[model samples]
Target: MTTHERSKAPAVDGAVLIIDLLASSAFPLTLSEICEKTGLPAASGHRIINALLEHQMVALNTSRKKSYCIGAKIFQVASTIYSKQSIIPFFYPIAEILKNEIHRPIFLSVPIGNTVVVVSKLESSLNATFNLHIGQTMPLHSSASGKAILSMFNAKEQLNYLAGQKKTSSHFSELLPKIKADLERAKRLGYAVSQGDIGQYVSCIAAPILNLRNEPIAAISTAVSNEFLTHQEARDFSKKLIQAARQLSSRIV
Candidate 1:
């Protein structure tokens, strides 16, 4: 064995291999699949996975039989890394300006694995029943912020995220086809819209903040009471959001 290989702890290496495998997969994998893919012995793989499960490093996919995916702890760590990026520090001032101009609650969200998590919000004067807080998770294919981010992903990446949904409800599962269609439209329009996809009587319009490579690093969105925003008002909000996104993207190196 090479020096690095000789120094490795077998159990730790196995655990890491399993983690890497799970991280790379779009959908969850069964224990047998994990072992088969990682070349780990069945017994060792099971034990390592159980240990990861106990520590919240891996989670069971209840939607799929005996399958596993990266857990909440991984997402937490990813969010921490995202918070330290240069883009995050620059977000608040831009979002604040957008919120003032639009007169709606503004949200900043970053992708944490396959989902988007809200990292900041600028509260609006309107007493809208719905409010998004920092650390709140949103569906990749549903919410405006999520959709905006998704729109920037390549087709395969977008489909992988969509296919990996936990399918919390049959209604959401049934909407997958439509959601895919909406993502395409979002790509063309340079923004995304959500009508009650998250909260009752709530609507959001969002645009993706891209990095130098033109990949979406995050999204900025405005939420308003659907009851109050007219079609023309929503259109105005979308234009403002797209502009803010472009401004923010320019700052990203």
Candidate 2:
């Protein structure tokens, strides 16, 4: 079988099956419960659980009676995967150039698991302004980086990502329709914008970065203090932002 086919193979081992069931549960389960759910006998389940716990793949809740859950090791593995797959190494120099050219903060963000995380940032050299740094995460519905990335997803994926997050206000219910309209607009305009949505005093413009498969793997954005950009300045800065994003995208897969 091809590597892709091998990667897609279903789980066969008892421990893996138990882990899958635990992942889908959304809540912790006890050892007995895991065995019950997987229809495994007690001795077999105990052995699998012991092995998993030894590797820190499964964790026992010390405060509860035999309660178990997925462990921090899973998150550690996820972080490693994200770090290795990151494009920040390729994008940072471009971000530095954009920051120098625009005199504003330039940020590179990727949708990691369920959150859009800033992996790299070039802060404005100007004496005073909003400060955004690496490792910050923004609301998927409110930030330009989030919108630019969201524009790349299909309707179902976009809706799924937005589900369950608290809206900015009761009026924020209107945001989904607005976001849909914005996505359409972004597709035509080649970039996205956030006007004081993430921060009352800051505005941003962003464009998507696509991978080898033409899937948007991330976004690059430039944010300026609202006071620093007049209406005409904002428009001009957006053009520059779009140009920078296009250049950055070309460097990626």
Per TM-score, the best of the predicted structures is 1
lDDT of 1 by residue, 183-214 (tens): 99999989988988667888888999999999
Query: What lDDT is obtained when candidate 2 is compared to the true structure?
Result: 0.75
Q: What C-alpha lDDT do the candidate models reach, one value each? A: 0.85, 0.75
Residue pairs with backbone atoms closer than 3 Å in model 1 (clashes): none
lDDT (Cα, tens digit) per residue for candidate 2, span 53-149 = 8889889877677888887787798688667855777777777777788787788888876567878777786835565666677776677888888
Q: TM-score for every candidate vs. truth?
A: 0.65, 0.62
lDDT, candidate 1, equals 0.85
Candidate 1's displacement at residue 191, Å, is 0.9
Worst 10 residues of 1 by lDDT: 1-10
Give candidate 2's TM-score: 0.62
How many clashing pairs per prediction, in order? 0, 0
